[model samples]
Each structure stands twice: as C-alpha cells, then as structure tokens.
Target: MPMLTDTIKEKLSSIQGLVFTEINNYPCIEVPKEKILEVAKKLRDECEIDQIRDVVGVDRFTKNDRFECIYNLYSHPLKIRIFLRVKLDSKNPEVESLCPVWSGANWMEREVYDMFGIIFLSHTDLRRIYMMDEYQYYPLRKDYPLMGLPGAVQLPKK
Candidate 1:
C-alpha cells in the first residue's frame, strides 16, 4: 500500500509555502493564507475531493495572533480524505468561505464564525447561527475562558 502522506506531499509540494500537518492522526494540508481558495478549488476538481465534511475554526490563544480555519474533505469513490487548515493572524483572522463551491458549507461556515468570531469574507448568508443576537464573545474560543458556575462553594479567606 502506498503511503497517503507521501503521495499527497509530493503532489502538493509545488503549491509554494504550503505546509502539511497531521490532525487527529489524519493527513492534513495547510495552505498559505493567500492560497486558500485557490488550493480549495484544486483539491475539489483536480484532486477529486467531492465532499466538504466540515468547516470549523481553532483558537490558539497561547500564541499571539493565532487562529485557523480547518476544512475536512472526502471522496466517497476514492475513499480518501484530506484536511485543509488555513492559518490566520489574530489581527485579521478572516478567510474567504468556499460556499460557492460547496453549498453545504453555508451553514458550517456560519456556525464556525459564530463560535470563533472570525469573519468569513464572501460567505453568503453569514450570520449568527447558534447564539442569540448581540452575543459578545465566541464561546468556542480558547481565550474566551470557559468557567463553571460562579461561587459554587464558599471558601474562607483571611
């Protein structure tokens, strides 16, 4: 059996500045900020990725200016999948949502935007999907500081 990672790396090595990563032990390709949409197109057509499984964002609060948009794609016929992760700086953690190519992405992208507070430029019908209107922070963001009920137990202090 051919190594999936090597095959993909060799095929995409020409996509300058592209990096490959492993997500949840699966093959993941990371494209440069400027090349996201282009790469997505290539992956869909030339690479035969027919399905957009999910679109979500990851918050790396430990690092300054750290955010990422992740796309999981697969092809039923080929039984192969690839993960595309696009890194964006916190100053402008925005990306062009590939809703045009994959209509299913419409809801997924909006949900990600709602949770990460990262704007997806050109994403049709971009709005708060899960949260109520005027909600301030992105709940899934690591920096959001998820906490339990306030003062669940009292502590004696001197």
Candidate 2:
C-alpha cells in the first residue's frame, strides 16, 4: 500500500470529484466522470479494495445534465471500503465496464444502464433486466412524470 498523505486526500477531495464521507469507520470516495476508471483502478490496485459489492445509478434530472453512477468496493484483506461515483451526461452516459476488474459488476452495471439509461461502455452484454422489452424512458429519472402524459386516456372508474 502506498503512503497516504493528507495532501493526497485533500487533492483527490478537491478535484470536484467523488463526494466522500466516512460512514461507520469507512472512507468512501467519489470520482468525477473523467476520473472514474482511474480512481477505480487506484482503489483496487493501490488501496486494495478488491471486492465489488454493488453498482447502481441515480437519476437526478433536476441537475442540468447527467445521472450519477455509484460503485461500492470492499477490501477483504484490508477490511476497508470505498465509494466511487461518476457523473455522466444523461443523453449518452457511458463508462468502461468494471467487470474486467470485478466480474460481479457485469450484471449490476447492466441493470443500472437498463433502468436509468446509463451506459456501460465496454460491457459485453448490456440488456434490459427488470423492465419490458420496449420501454423507452428511464423510469427512475426525477423528470419522468409517471402519473400521466398529455391526453392520456381517461379510463372509466368502476
């Protein structure tokens, strides 16, 4: 493990990248879009975060443009944890699949892409999981008004 410095921590924190927090004695880190993969590699190779717990996407349309991809990694040997986040453009959010590093990420990333419209760039098979085959809009987006659309058919009540 490399020597961690306060400067390095502050530098990574100040990059406008990776919102971080210490939860229950774990240091969680978030990385910006451009540094997502780089940070992930570091977490695994340098910091020894070798376990992939989950990958998920959050749709926040209120923001100007993009969804946030959340990655959770754990180090079995070191007993440490990390949280990685990447901001991607909503229109075409994409990232290299982390499956190459952690096979567990494959299906999780795909599910996130399917539901939130985020794309995993190098995923071998990115397909819809829970939703219907032809569903278009991302159901999780804040702006995805699900109640009704203009001129929606008004069904008679019983």
Candidate 3:
C-alpha cells in the first residue's frame, strides 16, 4: 500500500524510454515492449519488486495501439505496489515473458494470452485457461458480441 519512494523514483528514471507516472496516486511505469523484460529484471533485481500480483490485458480498440499489458508488481519488503504497462500493436500483440524472473508469472502470462490473444514470447506453457484450444475468438475483446458468437465454443449437452 506504500507509494514509491524518491530513491526508487531515481532508480527508475535512469532507464531510458521508461515513463514514470501515477494513476490514482499509485506509481505506474509505462515501458516499451522491447524493453519490458530488461525493465522487469531491473525492477526485481534493483528495486526489490519480488512479486507480480497480477497481469491484466486491455483492449483499446479505438487507439492506434490496440492492446495493452499491465503487470501489477509488489515489493514485499517495502510493502509497495507498482504497475508496469506496455502498449502493443493491434495486428500482432506480443511481448517477452517474465517467467524467468518470477516463476509465478507463467500462469498469469498464459491467462493474458488466452483472453487477449496477446502472445507472450518464450512462455513455456502458454495455453488457454478458460476457453478451449479451438476457440477462435477472444471473448474479452471489445469487438466480441455480448451474447458471444454462436458455435464459437461447444458446450457439453445437459
């Protein structure tokens, strides 16, 4: 629940192209997809952000960058939580996996990939969590119909 300290801010500022901002008073870092792995490593190794609380994907259909990946990170020792966000291209939204830094990220990354169709490069067990493997559409996407596409997924007969 703690806010980012001046020391942590200074450390984060050294990383080129990383924009440090706040949303609702919570520190958020917007990093380029190419630098996400490197920045994540720095955060874990240098900033002591040891855990990723959650991974979320956002569909920005109207924006030029149609996808976004957000990582909620926590520093247990400091009792601080921060957000890392990456914008992705609409045609092929992809980003490097952070499983190497934190093993717990494996499942979280997979969930994002499954729901958003955002490929997590180098994720060992990247697969669907809720939808079946043959499911074609990403239900969470803005373009998806509220009632869902008929025949998109086959349900067991009751």
Top candidate by lDDT: 3
Candidate 2 residue-wise lDDT, 34-73, digit = tens: 7676666666675566889988788776445568887877
Per-residue lDDT for 1-158 in model 3, tens only? 33355667777676789887777878888999999998899889988999998999999896678999999999999888889999998988989999999899999988898888999999999989988898988889999989999888788899
Q: Which stretches of model 3 miss by more than 4 angstroms?
A: 1-3, 155-158
- Candidate 3 versus truth, CA RMSD in Å, comes to 2.2
lDDT of each model, Cα atoms only? 0.79, 0.70, 0.88
The better-scoring model by TM-score among 2 and 3 is: 3
Q: What are the TM-scores, per candidate, against the unseen true structure?
A: 0.82, 0.74, 0.92
lDDT of 1 by residue, 53-126 (tens): 99868888756658888898887767887889888888878888888777889999999989888888898699
Candidate 1 lDDT score relative to the true structure:
0.79
How many angstroms is residue 70 displaced in model 2 relative to the true structure, after the best TM-score fit? 1.1
